[model samples]
Each structure stands twice: as C-alpha cells, then as structure tokens.
Target: MRLPCIEIIGCIAAIVTVLKLVTLDTFVFGDVQETFILFLNVHFLAALMVVFALAISAYKYLRLGIELMPIEKYVFRILISLAAFTGIWALSTEIIRYFNYQELTSAKSVSDIENAKQLA
Candidate 1:
C-alpha cells in the first residue's frame, strides 16, 4: 500500500532534522561567537520541526486506524513523549554548557578586556 501524504511530509521533515543536527557546524556564516548564537536559534527551530513531524505521524496513525488505541490513550503518550524529549534536550544543553563553561567565560572576559582597553 502507498504511504499517505502526511507520512511523506513527516519522513522528509525527519530527514531534514537529522541532517541539520549532524552538520550544525557548517551552518556558521561568521565568527565562532556569532555562529554559536545563531546555532542556538537554529537548533530550537530544528527541534520544533521534529516535534511537528511527530505530531503529524501520530495523527496519521490515529486517524488511519493503524492502531486500536483510543485518542485518550494517545494523550498520555504524547505528554510523556514531550516530557522525555524535553528532558533529553535539557540534559544535553547542560552537558554542553558544563563542558564549555571555561571557554564561554574566557570569551566573555576577553571581550570585556577589549572593551576596557578601548575606553581607556
């Protein structure tokens, strides 16, 4: 049987999300600090796209009669999934922040020194 349009869109979005995440460094268009700032926004948008795809897929499966689970049942599933996804993302960001704490602090210090020198 042929796949539905929703499935196609979801699949394409999923692929794009994965590709974007994997090659995040290449998306930089400027210096490291600027690139990091831009990357934060891009990553959030990419994550939203992934959640959108998941929503579409869930709707398709529910309405198309693929699974016998009731709509009410899926509400819990969706909530749990969202919580899990958020938790993982939060953990990842913390890990990155922890590891790069020194680099980020140093960058700020360096910028502050430059600004002070300019004002003196």
Candidate 2:
C-alpha cells in the first residue's frame, strides 16, 4: 500500500530536526572531528530520506494516479521545500566551518615553522 504524502513529509521533517539537534550537540560540546562524523552521518541520512520520500510520492501520483487531500497537498509542498532548504543550509554551514578550521590550523603550523627556523 502507498503511504500518504503528508506522512512521508512529516517523517522527513522529523528526521531533519533530529539531525540538526545532533549537530547542535557537537557544536555546543566542543567534540573532536571523529565525534563530528556522527553529525555528518545524520545529515546524509536525512537528505537521503527526503529524496526517497519525494521519489515515492512522485511515483505514486504519476503512475498510480493517486491524489492528495487539499491540506496534505499544501503541507506536503511546504514540508518538502523546507526540508530541502534546511538540508542545504546545514551542509553549507558545516563545509564553511570545516574550511575555516583548516585555514586556522594551517596558518598556525606555518607560523610555528617560521618561529622554529628563527630559533635554530
């Protein structure tokens, strides 16, 4: 049996929220990069679930000719859009933070090398 679009969308939104919370936890606790892998995994899973839901919804509507109720139609649209937007936002934030962290560490290493050269 095919699932309703709203249910699928709700599941996606809930997953995304949970993933965001996990990432927030890492950010707040000063966790190591290894621990941050959990956050990345959560993000990946959330994105995957959203994509899967969209595909299922499309197949059911297009192939099976199933229709959603008025409220479910609008809410599904909003939830899917929000899920895509927030997923992109979260991923980009993580990428920017990673690059910034890399830049800072590299600069510090370069400065340390120069200092050692002067001391030798």
Candidate 3:
C-alpha cells in the first residue's frame, strides 16, 4: 500500500523539530550556556507541543482523505519556517543578554567582593 502523504509530512516535521531541539539544548551552536532550570523545561515542552501538533494534524488529514498541499507548496512553507526560526533566534538572544546584564549590574551581596558592601 502507498504510504500516506500525511505520514510523510509528519515524519519530516518531527525530524526537523527534534533536531532543532537537540541542537539548541546541546549547545551545538557553541555558545548556548543556558543552564537555567526554567529555560530547559520550556524548550523541551515547546518542542514536544509542536511535534504533537504537527504530527497529529498530518495524520488526521491522511485518515480523512483530505489533500495536503503538493510539493510545489513546500517552498512557501520553507520560507515561512526560515523567517519564524530567525525571529525566534533573535528574540531569545536578546532576552538572554538582558538577563545576563541584569545579573552583572546587581550590586555585590557577599564578602567575595568587599565584606561590608551592598549586602548590608
């Protein structure tokens, strides 16, 4: 039997999403130092959500005999994905930098700095 197109698309989407999650969480970019518990949880959860959403919807279309856009439409999908991914990268970088700056600017709170300084 012919494998359904929905399955095909779902597989592709799942692979891409998981690969991205790995790259980000593994610091494959060489600069990701996010060790914060919250950020790690958020990234994993978000990736899971996106994977389930895309996979389920693709499977639905296959079972219902609905037509997914043909391969010709993939170019548009790719372009949109690129734009959204770029935006995400840009925004995450900005937020991380802002938080790091905040941490640095906070006055010393221990003797490690000067013993009787801002901690008092």
Query: Estimated TM-score per prediction?
Result: 0.43, 0.52, 0.33
Candidate 3 per-residue C-alpha lDDT over 23-105 given as tens digits, one digit per residue, 9 for 90 to 100 = 66533322323433334445434654664555455445455443444653353344345435544654475466446545644
Off by over 4 Å in 1: 1-16, 19-32, 35-40, 66-102, 110-120
lDDT of each: 0.53, 0.55, 0.50
Ranking by TM-score: 2, 1, 3
Query: Candidate 2: where are CA atoms >4 Å away?
Result: 1-67
Which residue pairs in candidate 1 collide? Answer: none
Clashing pairs in 3: none
* Residue 60 lDDT, candidate 2, scale 0-100: 45
- Worst lDDT run of 10 residues, candidate 1, spans 25-34
> What's the CA error at residue 48 for candidate 1, in Å?
1.7
Better of 1 and 2 by TM-score: 2
lDDT of 1 by residue, 37-114 (tens): 432555445555555655665565556564443534454355346535644563465346444554776989999999
lDDT of 2 by residue, 5-113 (tens): 7666655665566466446532532433333453465444555565556545544444443365554445445545655665576576567556655666688899999
| Candidate with best lDDT | 2
Model 3 score (lDDT): 0.50
